[model samples]
Target: MKIKDLFKNKEVTLSFEVFPPKTDDGYEAVEKAAARIAELKPDFMSVTYGAGGGTSKNTGNIAADLQDKYGVPVLAHLTCVSSTRDLVREVVKSYREKGIENIMALRGDIPKEGRIAFDYNHATELIYDIKSLDESFCIGGACYPEGHVECERQSEDIIHLKEKVDAGCDFLTTQMFFDNSTLYQFLYRIREKGIEVPVVPGIMPITNKRQVARSVALSGSTIPQKMKIMVDRFADDPEKLKEAGIIYASDQIIDLISNGVSHIHVYSMNKPDIAEGIMRNLSTIIR
Candidate 1:
């Protein structure tokens, strides 16, 4: 099902994201994790594209499995920074052939070695290409609550986001954010700027001490003092930290729903245990 239509019919929607294995050896483990999460039956599940398309085939395979075997709707991610125009079209066609209906188009992170291809520089261009191939696909683009790390100013970032939406993005999903107030402010600014599509806030459950630095470094998300305190208190015990992290993320989601943000996307990675913990926390609210 197209995500836009899902939003129209449901008052609240919750989704999870899983990534393809980085190498062939781990493919079965990752697929098993995705299957377990799919059993939870979120409104939909999104399969992330690996950096530089290293795991692109696994992405399609996992997405197809989620949709066909588990009966879960899937959103397959496609990145264009490291791919050519023909490659992008081929991936889109492959998705269509597998019955995938939604795509999250992105101008992926530049590789450590440097970009290999320049066929597409911005996500807007990728969105355009996806639409040109088939307007029937529902495309989702990324947004930043604290502004994109590469962009110096939040205003400029929103301008680019508007252009992305104008290109053909059906909806926007934000990078993971720790504070709900940040998203509330971002929503106000985007709405005032006339970008009115449904914005789904992506939530990341920081289950361990190591994830804190890595996630913050990658996303540029500000860790509030309260979050710091939680980490400081529980950092020593893995189980305690995991529990605290789940609670922290669940609290964030409840606040978002309370404030009338109905759709949520959790960056569940490949940990079925963490995904299940979150669903257990929101059993009554999501229903």
Candidate 2:
């Protein structure tokens, strides 16, 4: 099913993201974790592509399994920064052969060693390439409510975002944000700019202290004072921190839904328990 179709009914939708393991030896473990999350029966599941397409094969395999074994529609990711145009076509072809209909197109993080290839520079270019290969695939692009780390200004980021949507992206999913107000403001700004696709807010539950620095460093998202206080209070207790984190994310989802944001995607990060915790909290609301 195309992800865009999932949003047409104006019904609330929830989805989870899982990533393939870095090495072959860990493939089975990652697959098992993805399966457990699929069993939660989210509206759909997305499998992330590894940095530089290192785990592209496993990404295809896991996405196929989720769609075939668990009967979950899968959105497989494809990153273009480190890849040649030929490689992008090959991956898109493999996804089609696997019965995957949706793709999250990304430019991916630049390797610490610097960019290895230069076939694509921006995500908009990748979006164009994907559409040229298969117009049937539903493409989702990433947005940042608090602005992307590389882009200095949110307005400039939105301008780039408009190019993606204009190129052929069916919808947009945001980088995770701690404050709902941030998303509200972003939505207003984007709508004013004339980019009107359904934007799904991505929520990452901060279950551990380590995730804070890494997520912020990667996303450039602001850590609101309320979130800071919660982390400080429960950072020491593993179980308490986990529980608090789930509740915090659930509250964010509830607020989004109440304010008419119909679709929410969780950066579940292959943890079935965290995914289950969020689902259990919203059993009645999502249904």
> What is candidate 1's lDDT per residue for 180-217, written digit by digit as tens?
99999999999999998999999999989989899989
Kindly give the stretch of ten consecutive residues in candidate 1 with the minimal lDDT sum: 50-59
- Candidate 2 local lDDT, 163-220, one digit each (tens): 9999998999999999999999999999999999999999999999999999888888
Off by over 4 Å in 2: none
Scored against the true structure, residue 86 in model 2 reaches a CA lDDT of 93
lDDT for every model? 0.94, 0.93
What lDDT does model 1 reach? 0.94
